[model samples]
Target chain A: MKRLTRSAQRALDRYLHTLRTCLTGSNAIDAHEVEHDVLGHIEQELSECREPIAWARLQIVLDRLGSPLMWVPEHDLPSWKQLLLRLRIGPEDWRLAYASFALWMLAVVALLAAYEPIALGALLGSFVTARAARAFGGELDQSDRSKRWLTEPALATAALVLGGAVLLSVLPAMALVSRELVEIDTLRLQFPSVYHISQRLVAVFERPVSWGWIRSALLHGGPWLLLPLGAWWLVLGGIARWRPRWFAITFSPGRPNCAARVGRLLMIAGALVIGTGVAIGLVKTLSIAI
Target chain B: MKPRKDLRPEKWTTQLRKGVLELCVLNVIATGRLYGYEIAKRLSALSEPTVREGTVYPILSRLKQEGLLEATIEASSEGPPRKYFALTAHGRRRLRHMNAAWDLLDDNLKTLRRRTAP
Candidate 1:
């Protein structure tokens, strides 16, 4: 067998890279198996030719093999996998949707574990879900118009409910559980020194406070916390309905306009300011009551 | 007058080709054990709408997974080891049934064409 020329090898590498991209996330065949088979086929063809194969000749052979996208057998996928694939935001970008959903779930778990913030988890979850829903909406646009209102709105509503549950319910429940684990008598007895230190710290920070005010504030303020997020979801859903491109632009920072960039920066700053204010209020209220 | 954009022939041919491609692939392998490129080359040579080598690998992989075909990696003098695919016992039985079905379909189609001839 004769070795390929340097230029030919480089061209083959680039071709294989594009082929690999097209074959990614394919469930029908192992990517490595296909790559190995393709490489073997190419080498077999190359070996039959004279020594020092020309780069153009190699390209011609690759072209004859056709685009790698042609080899992605969608029918080979199981029904459930196909359904999940349809949940994507773009053509051939189902992998992004899957990755984002996986990350969103991980962020949700972290929030429930009390290892992350409610706001952060809510933001991540809503962002990814919105992106995925946007992709689904795009597909819906090209599909039957009769089903558009039903499916797209339903998806947005589900996302909003999930975001609210994650923020209001899961985060608070986990925080309560974490607080109880620390405050429990049996656990406190097991860590007497730690408990004593915590008590001393609490005593130092303690201030006189009425329990009624805190209770009433929580009863009133808890529901209000969801207002900003609910409004955001409504606005997002409205944009997604009327102008999907605008919805896409709002979330996708890769090709953002100058206005979007500035808006995103301002939103981040506002979130930080609000988050800090909430943290301070919570600390002050808890110090007085606990 | 605008030319009629009749697409039924192309569409029907595409569907027909897809339907028979697997059966054709099985028949090709039944002749002898063949590597990926060999199978593709033989099929493209024998059939319409030439089968590219890349298209052959997935079908080969699917057949192998379905227990209709099995592959073995053999060391090659040229480059990487070649995965040679051959029919399993089940595959032979499937090929027999598929061949019988094809013959029946072919006979019926021939009779229909003869009857309809002007």
Candidate 2:
């Protein structure tokens, strides 16, 4: 057989990878025998060609064989495998399913670790996964176009709320467990400034504070910020649903409406608030250091 | 008399070709053993809608699994070792039955066509 160029070899590898994916989890045919036969066929074709093998030429041969997914005779597949194919969100949504499952697993791990940052991120990840799944499912379920808009957003919102609730409930237990395992003195020594800040804040409030209390306060307080944002999103969604014309006019290019103007003003106000807060916090820290 | 028309001739021919492809593969290997590439080449050369090399392998694999075909790996001078396939005794018996069925079907269809011809 004529030697394959570097690019041609890569193309062949990709073609084989697709074939492997199609063959995996399939019980109707012996994957090994089919794979070997395919390789042999490619080699024979290359040998017959007078020119050196290139990606364009190899692509022509691969395309003639058709898509690997099409090669599997669905009727020959076992009942379980047939069911799996039918249940799949879309023709290529297996990747999304795997991603969603992985994110859920990570959320569990983050909850166990009592890491609020990672846990929150994981909750958002689940929302994204749910949204992606719904989008793909909608594309596949084209017959139900009217229901797609409602169902997908509802599913995504449910995933977000449920995942967040589970994470929140587990967090307090995780903090309590961590507090009992670790010594307060060691924690103060390890994070002196953080301990000092908690102490000062507790003193101002005239209340007792510990590492666990500080962590709980911070973690719980973080999600309160999301409430307003979520409400805003819902408001926008409601407006879009009830008055699409107004929503479109508000967002229309070059000609902004009252809502758009108000939104822009609010955004600017938010940025100013955050900027001022950060600047104040920076100045205070610097003054204390001096 | 008026001749009957196949409204979807292309679709009908496609289904017919797919149904007979396995039988054609059996007939190709009836004379002697041939590798997947060689079998595909012979079929494409002789038939319309050229049999692709990729399409031929799965059929070979299915046949081998069904006990109708057996294969052995032989080292080649050109590149990798090639798998050569041959029909088994059971395969030959099955082929004989398939051929008889094909002949019967073909004869009956022809007779029907003759009666309907203009």
Candidate 3:
């Protein structure tokens, strides 16, 4: 016989006492039956344990077996299926949050592109910076307190500051670029090659017939574009609250499966190249008639 | 199984719990060489409050892997013959070294705390 330690013996004694209570109780007939079933289950587990049972060790085993809930008729405890479902929680929720973020970004791009292509580009640069902050914020782990920025307001503040700085930097540069592009378009109108190329490209889309129309396009489209982005931000924030690490994994690029991702990128690039080539060829044919 | 997110984390007080196996195995063998269950029970008594399936076996496997312990089959009545663990000379030396280090660490912590006190 493998001698049990005093502590192990004590734990077992407590367990047996609980078991006895469950089985021998004078109350419910069902409780007594359940006790017999529980004893059989416990015996099966103990037999498989292969080692001598100690008091403390026994308690751990019992806990793992889910504390063997008492057979209460009215309690709202989760069923086995529910418990299993809770444990098998998927990353779908995080993926939905990420899709929301991507949509938000597209909305912002639409806004900026309408306001001023250059300013839109600048806003894009800022958005990229904001994204970096979010990535770092998401990487924070619970086991390591020092890394958690949510609890430390200073870290969050720092990230916000950096993101804002990026946005500010991009905006002015975009405005300057847009102004220069407008000025250059005016000066180049008299040059045959420049004018022809510009006219061909310009004709591909519905031209803004007047400068006023251009200004109106910018003003009207700008805020409307940001709506999706705002929604995305809210969705991402919600996801982060639900399961921070999963949210990070869903949004953060440069994930482990980079090779498969590269294949997708290559396919998209090929399609874009083909489309651009066809567009240029069509413009050339249209210009020849002119 | 994933730990419950809502419950308070369990606090293990003693430093020995950090490397409970080496010490516990040594303590168990101090009487006589015994099998896996015997050693696990002894350790569970002193600390662990509970032991379970697959827990002690890993520690035993680790000790054997490190060459501090060796296992051999012994006749038993409960089931199949049991695999008992005994400390090698190397194991005994390691236990001594671990004990010395633990003592040194404990003493330093105490001294530092005492000095820092107001």
**Which parts of model 2 have CA positions greater than 4 angstroms off?**
A1-7, A25-28, A48-52, A83-290, B1-9
| Candidate 1's DockQ | 0.37
TM-score of the second chain, cand. 1:
0.87
Stretches off by above 4 angstroms in model 3 are A1-290, B1-16, B50-54
Provide chain B TM-scores across all predictions.
0.87, 0.88, 0.73
Taken in order, the candidates have interface RMSDs of 1.7, 1.9, 14.6
Model 2: per-residue lDDT, tens digit, A1-290?
A: 46776556766775776677666676557778788778777777676776667666877778667556556666767777667655642345445545665666676688799987886687567556655654443322233344344334434445357535532443344344434434467668888765555454333223245676645544433232223333444455455455555643323211235445544554554454445445555665687799
TM-score of chain A of each: 0.26, 0.29, 0.23
Say which candidate scores most in lDDT.
Answer: 2
Leading candidate by DockQ: 2
Decreasing DockQ order of the candidates: 2, 1, 3
- The stretch of ten residues in a row with the least summed lDDT in candidate 2 chain A is A247-256
Ranking by TM-score: 2, 1, 3
- lDDT-sorted candidate list, best first: 2, 1, 3
Model 1 over residues A207-242: C-alpha lDDT tens digits? 233676445433433323333434444444444455
> Relative to the true interface, what fraction of contacts does candidate 3 keep?
0.00
Q: Rate residue A190 of model 2 by lDDT.
A: 87
